[model samples]
Target: MQPTTPLFLQKFSSNAPESKELQRLTSFENVENKNRDTYLDMIRIFINRNHVYRRGHVEFIYSALKNMESFGVQKDLEVYKALIDVLPKGKFIPTNVFQAEFMHYPKQQQCVIDLLEQMEDNGVMPDYEMEDLLSNIFGNRGFPLRKYWRMMYWMPKFKNSSPWPVPSPLPDNIYELAKYAIQRISSVDVQSQITVYQTKEIESSIDDTWIVSAQAPSQKDLLKNHDLKEPVYVEGSFRIWVKDQLVNYFVLKRQPKQHIKTIKDDLDDVSNIRTPIFSFQKPIEKQVQVMQSVHEQEDGVILAVCATGTSTKDSLLSWIRHLEKDGNPVLSDALVVFTLRTGTREVATVNNVEQKQIESK
Candidate 1:
C-alpha cells in the first residue's frame, strides 16, 4: 500500500535529504525488493546529482556493486559506462576501491581500457590538472609503467601532454664547470673543508694579493693591498670574490669564538644536528652565485680568504697535499704557497709548484 512514486525518487527530489538517500536505499532491508533496473535508475540519479566522484561516492559505488551481486543483479555495459561517465574530471579515483572493483572483473577492466582508447582517438588527452592527480595516485602506489602504458604511448599525439616539463641540459663550458664546483662544495659535509677550483679563463689574471696566515690579520695588514688613490677599501674592508664572482668582504675583527660557541651550544641539544642545520641553510643559492660569477671575473681565481687559525691552515695544506698525491693535472702544475707572518717578518714556503699545460676549455 506504499506510494508508487518510490522512496528513492522522492528523497532525490527533495531539496536536501537528512542522510545519503542512495546509501539508505542500498541498505539490506530496503534493497531486498529493488530489482536491477531500480538499482541502475538509483545509480543514474546519484550520478546526475553529484557529478564529482569523491572518496565517499567511490565507496558508495563499491558498496552498490557488492549489493547488486547479493541481489543477483547483472551489471550491463551501460551501467559501467554510466559509472565512468560520472567520474569527476581531473580527479583521482580512490586506488584501493578502484582496483578492488575493476581489477578482478575482466569485462570491467576491458571497459576501462576501451574508454581510455576512445578518449585518445577523440583527441581528449588528460589535461595538466588530471595528469597531476594521476601522477599522485600512480606514484604513491608505485604503479608499473606498463600498467598505464596506453596513456603514455598515446601522449605524443597531443601537444602540451607532458605534465612535468624537463629543462634542457646545460652546455659544457666554464659556466657549467663553475656550477659544478659550487655544487660539489655545497654538498660536502659541514665538518669537511670546501675546496673550489678556478676556471682557466679567470686563472690567468688572478690577483697575487692573497696570503695565508696562521692567525687573524690586523686592520693595517688587511688594507695593505688596497690602492690608496682609488680607495678600494671601504672602512678598511674590501669585497673579494669567494665562490666565483659572488663578492663578500671580510671585516678585520677578532676570531668569532663567541659566535661559534653559541652555535655549538644550540646544536648540542639537537638529536640530529646534521639534517636540521644543513637543510635550514639552503646551499643551492651559494652554488647559483658561484655559477653567476664566471662571467664577471677578469683576474686570476678569486679566493675570498677568511682569517682563521691552525685548523684552516691544516685543512688547506691537507687539500694541497691530496691534489699533489693524486697527481691532479690542473692543480699539480700551479704553485701553492703559504706565507706565515711573525711580527713584521714574513716566512714563505712553496707548497707545490709543478708546471703542466692546463687543458683547453
Candidate 2:
C-alpha cells in the first residue's frame, strides 16, 4: 500500500481512531440487518413449503422463534400468526393461530375474536390442520362462548380434544361474531367450501340406498355346440342400482369374456358416459379385486354398479356378504360401477384414503 501523504487521507485511514470506531459500527449494523433478513427469509420458506414436507418439519415454528431472538416478542408473535395464516392442511393438522397468539398476550384474546369474526365475514374456512393448533393455544380456558358457538355452528365435525358446550341464548354480540367468523372462514378458501358443499349435495341426493348383482343376456341356446347353433345366452346378470335407476347397468351373460376386459380398459373413458355418475378411486382395481371371487366360480366377472346413493361402497360389501350368508354363489367375476356426479366418489376416496388436501390455487 502507498504511504499516507495528504492530511485528509491520514485522518480517514483505518489507522485513525475515529475511522476504526466507524468501521465497527458499520459492521454491527450490517450484522443486525442480516439477522432480520434471515428471519424474514425463514418465514417465507416455511410458508411456501409443501404440506407433506412441512409436517416433517413440525418444529419449524419453534426453531424460527429461537433464531429470531433479536426481534421484539410482540412482533415475533405477529409474524408467527402471519405464517400460520398461510399454511395448508395436509396429513398434518391446522393450528388455531388466533388462540395461540392470544396465549402469548391474553389481552389479545379480543384481537383473536376480531380476526376470527373478520375471516368469517369473508367466507373463508381455515385449513383443517388449524383445529388442533388452535385448541392447543386456546384450550378450554381462553376461548369464550362466542368462539365455541362459531366453531360448532359453522365448522364441520373434526377431531377436538375437549367437548364443545352448546351456547344457549346466544348473545347479540355472539351472533355478530358468528356471522363474521363464517364469512372469514369461507373467504380463506372458497374452493374448499364449494367442494365441501358439493360433496354434501351428492351425499344427500344419493343417501344410503344401493344394489349389486350379476348381469344376464335375454335368450339361451338349447342345442349342443356341435349342432347347428342358436343364439346362446348366459343366465346370470350383472348390475347395480340406486333409487331404482339404471345409471350404470351393464349386463352380458352370453357376451364374450373379452367384454370385461374391454370395460375395464375403457373405464376412464366411459367414466363420463353416464350423467351424475361418480367413479370410485382406482375403478379398475376395485372391479378386479372386488369381483375376483365371482370370476373364479362362474368363469365370468361379476359387475357391481351403484345407481344412486352414498352407500355404494357399503352396498357392494353387503352384496358380497349376502352372497356368503345365503349360500349364493359369490360373483368375484363382477365389476362394480357407480353412477353419480363426475369424479365425485373417486376424488372423495382419494382425499379420504390418502390424506390429500386442497392447496390454494
Winning candidate number (lDDT) = 1
lDDT of 2 by residue, 1-361 (tens): 9764444234444344333533333232234554554455445544444343334233444444344445432233345455444333232222566644455334334445554554444323454444454554444445532474566566555323223222322344432333223333223222212111112223223234433232211111111111212111222223322111222322222222322442344545755554346644443343443232232224433222112123243333343333323322322222222222333321122112221233322
lDDT of 1 by residue, 1-361 (tens): 9656465566555354435655665453465566667667766556545333333455454555556445544324344445454445433333475654444334433444454454454334444443344344333332321334556666665445443222223234433333333333323222223233222222332232222211112222322332323212001123332222332222112111111122223325667455765586753322111122221124222222332112233333333333333323323333333322222211112243332333222
Q: In candidate 1, which residue ranges exceed 4 Å CA deviation? A: 1-10, 14-22, 50-55, 73-75, 93-361
List per-candidate RMSD values in Å: 25.3, 25.9
TM-score of each candidate structure, all chains considered together: 0.24, 0.18
Q: Candidate 1: global Cα-lDDT? A: 0.37
Would you list the clashing residue pairs of candidate 1? 205-299, 205-300, 206-299, 206-300, 245-293
- Predicted candidate 2, C-alpha RMSD: 25.9
Ten-residue segment with the worst summed lDDT in candidate 2?
Answer: 217-226
Compute the lDDT for candidate 2: 0.34
In candidate 2, position 135 carries an lDDT of 50
